[model samples]
Target: MDVFRSMQIMVRAIELGNLSAAARELGVTQPTVSKIIAALERDLAVRLIERTTTKFTPTEAGQRFYERAKQILEEYADARADACGLSAQVAGLLRVNAPLGLGEMHLHRITQCFVRLHPKVEVELVLNDRFVDLVEEGVDLAIRLGGALPASAVARDLATSERFFVASPDYLAQHGAIEHIDDLQRHEFIRFAWLESGATVEVAGPDGSRHIALRGRYSINSALSIRQSVCDGWGIAMTPAWLVQDLLDDGTLVRILPRWQAAAQTLRLVYPSRRYQPMRARAFMDYLESEIEAVPGLTTSRPRC
Candidate 1:
């Protein structure tokens, strides 16, 4: 039995919860994955998985082995990368996760440039609207838009994002323009549902930083949806200025209460702690930070140190 390959396959199967999915991720056939798992189980003389009609559960022994297997696989990858001079070259698969709107608008160009600079590097961009567990999801890095991150991860500020209260020209013409925060209560608001708690947002405006309890005619978790609704004259929304810059410039959307600014959210480049960050991972983070710094509104232009 190829013990290492079997271990890798089993670990991936446990993570993905099925053989077919694991096979697809590993670039192998389902039968091959099944055979490998079966062989490994027979050799070990322990049933690693409990398969039922509806689900696959790892046995206690399976869980223990999987934990060690992941470490072994990661170490092996690190050693291989080091041997190939990847420590000196930015070359490998970089798995990155970011908000869908930011990924489509901002990250796409940066990723293209990074790939151009390092032709050997491959980037897997997962544009998810929901917050993902980087360690559990096997992501190398994530672009987070908010304040400081949890202590479990290391973060660097990529930019300071300014929030704007905006509405479409048609919506303002119909509902009349809002000159103050209190005016929001008189109109329909579109809220972005928090991913962790599915709860609607009660945002604070700049004046007195008073929390405004908003009522949305429609609520969704997607930033894109909120932008679209505002564009369609559904309602006024509080969104990041970076997202609506083009719309504001082109007269598609107009900013209300332009003199008042809401709390700024920091754009962060977050990754697992250094202990867990491999050379390839660090390289990707470095590339991302450099690229983001070059973008307008992220930071003031300065000579590279």
Candidate 2:
């Protein structure tokens, strides 16, 4: 039996949660995939996967083996690339994930430029506002806003996103000028759906951070929707500067509470913790880091250690 080939099949099967899907991806028949997996189990004298009619999951031992097998496959790929004198070549499918707002506003353009530089590389950009399980979702890399890092992956700080309290010029004209912090309570706040922190909005300034009670007539999960709602003269929103920079510049939106801003959020790139990452992934990360300055309202400077 080809041990290496079997390992590849098993790894892909576990990742995809279906032997047939793995077979399709690896260009083999489903029966071939099942036969190989059965052979592996018999050889090891252990059941590697716990499968039901609708569910498939790796056992504890299988999980350990799967992790090591992935590392081995990466190492083998790297060795093959070097031996074939193709160490510098970047050719493969790279799955990238990012939030809906950032993905639509900047990541699409960045990916366009990246593919132009490396024509051999193909990128699948997945955009959503919900939390993503990187390994389970088969994502190669992810660009995420502020959150604690999971132990399964390594994170690289990319940039800082400064947020602001913004509203349409028409809304401000109709609601009267917001001359002080206390004035915010009288206006409607287009809140994010995920934020269940009551009606309070947090602001940071020279005096320190504080939360002030606010009213909201509307709420949505998407950042793009929030931006649109604000632009359509719905109400005020505390949104990321990157999301509304163009609107502010074009006089479609105006920044409120300039002296006190929402706490800045860090943009990070996260990927599985493999010792040997593919040349394609490394090159993509480096390229994205270098292009940080191109994203509006995001600063390249990280905080001093």
Candidate 3:
């Protein structure tokens, strides 16, 4: 038995929470993954995984071993990279995760260009709107859009984002224009269901700041859907500048509060904290930075220290 291969399989299975997912990631049959895991358990003489009909979980011992195994794998990757002169070459599978709207807009292009530059590298992009744990999901990195992140997360700021309230021209024409912040309450609102904000929204305008308590009939989780609704004249919605810039220019959506500013967000690249880093992941991040800087809205023209 190849102990190294089995360890890799065992670690993937635990991280993915299923044998089939691990197999798919590793490009092997499900039975092959199961067989390797069984051999690993037999050799270790411990029950590492607790399987059930609904789900699979790692035992306490399994959790401890999994953490250590991940460390070992990282260290091995670094050492092998240096030994094989792979420090200059990026050749490996790179799995990336990001929000659906952002991914659809630019991440595919980013990955495509990176692959073109490094033909030896394989890329996987998973666009999801829900929160994902990088370690548990076996993700190499994630593109996150938020104001602040967890204290323990390792992240790099890629750009600054500004949010704006927008609506279709026909909707605003029919519903009456919002002359002041107080007028927002009178208009129909489209709310993002996953957003933690309460029913009320506080806005900062040219004159001052005020709060508007909204009673939106439409609530959705997807930014794409919200943009569509706003374009279709459903209601006024708020979104980042990057996601709706095209719509704004093409006259599909119009900015509602030009003087009133919404919350700003930071575009970030987040990863699980670790002592050693993978060469491929690092290379890809560098490539991404270069690619993002060229895009007009993704990043600013200012230099970083």
> Highest TM-score among the candidates is held by which one?
2
* Candidate 2 structure quality by residue, lDDT tens digits, 1-305: 89999999999899889988999999999999989998999999999999898888999888878878877887788789899998888877788999988999899899889999988899999999766877667687999998788898999999887887999889988889997888989888898886768568789876788898889978989899999999998999988878888888888999988998988989999998867777788999999998867777888774444
Query: Candidate 1, which segments miss by more than 4 Å at Cα?
Result: 12-47, 53-68, 84-86, 147-152, 194-207, 294-305
List CA RMSD, all candidates.
4.0, 2.6, 3.2
Best by lDDT: 2
Worst 10-residue lDDT window, candidate 2: 296-305
Per-candidate TM equals 0.77, 0.92, 0.85
Q: Residue by residue across 225-272, what tens digits does model 1's lDDT show?
A: 888999999998888877787788899999887766667768888886
lDDT against true structure, model 3: 0.82
The sequence of per-residue lDDT tens digits that candidate 3 reaches over residues 1-305 is 89888888888898778899999999999999988988888999998999898988998888877877876886788788889887677787788999898888878888898899987889899998766777666688899988466564699888877776888999988999977777778888998885777566767778787676877888988878887889899888767888888888888888987998677767889987876667788998888877776554565545756
